[model samples]
Target: MHHVTQIKEFKVIDTCRDAVVINTNIDDYKAHAHFADIRGALECISLINRGLLPKSRYYKTACKRLLTPEQYEGLVERTKEKYININKGVRR
Candidate 1:
């Protein structure tokens, strides 16, 4: 049997009723990139929320690099929480 990959599509509607469709194949590399992007965005938010964004450059870099480790798993959990909330139509 041959393996087949399914492409998933996401649909979103704006306030003005404009609809947008995004096609995501989610290959391994793309999936890794998406995870990294989400982590990086969450790390930025964490730094800003903790008032560390304007701190030492070294600290900011280190935070972004280490914030997704097993010890810092809360960051990923927070990201998922925000994702769910947004999907539930809870606007920030």
Candidate 2:
């Protein structure tokens, strides 16, 4: 069987009262580019755009639960956390 890949997208409307989830697959190299580590900072913001999950609190919950691996999990996680929380409400 072929392996499955998942992408999450969120859209929000009316003071967070509306939300949705759109799913897609990354079949090639470039398809995964949108989700690169350099892109992690805007992940939650992007998720909000499609509406699957809420912003702020959900993002904070995700950040707080992030665990680092002993080897390849330091700079990436730290940078992502900083970018995600820098403005909290605004995503840059």
Candidate 3:
């Protein structure tokens, strides 16, 4: 028997002095979003982490800092579970 695991990871695909692009890994088409800066990008990530925003939609960034390491890890775990439950009804 074999067991397979799927890891959902987001990547920062591009960065510039005034903007950054991150591949959010939530869409089948590999959707990416643009932010004015790293702080903005991280803020979007944080909102997604907290469940305050929906994963299937693109969001604009706000002027805020990233979450703490511990906070982020906890949120990631919760988000993963939520995503799994949400996908249970859909056949892939």
State, as a TM-score between 0 and 1, how close model 2 is to the true structure: 0.20
Clash totals, every prediction: 0, 9, 0
**Residue 68 CA error for candidate 1 (Å)?**
27
Q: Write the per-residue lDDT of candidate 1 for residues 1-92, one digit (tens) a residue.
A: 22222222221222232222222332322212111233343444445345444244543444344333432333322222334544776677
Please state the error at residue 92 of candidate 1 in Å: 62
Query: How well is each residue in 1-92 modelled by candidate 2, as lDDT tens digits?
Result: 22222334322121222222222232222211222232343464444344334235555443223211221123232223334555567856
| C-alpha TM-scores of all predictions | 0.21, 0.20, 0.39
The TM-score of predicted model 3 comes to 0.39
Greater-lDDT candidate between 1 and 3: 3
Backbone clash tally (model 2):
9
Q: Which residue pairs in candidate 3 collide?
A: none
Local distance difference test scores for all models = 0.33, 0.32, 0.42
Q: Clashes in model 1: which pairs?
A: none
In candidate 1 the C-alpha lDDT for residue 20 amounts to 22
Output the lDDT of residue 55, model 1: 48
Give me the candidate number with maximum lDDT.
Answer: 3
Q: How much is 15 displaced in model 1, in angstroms?
A: 19
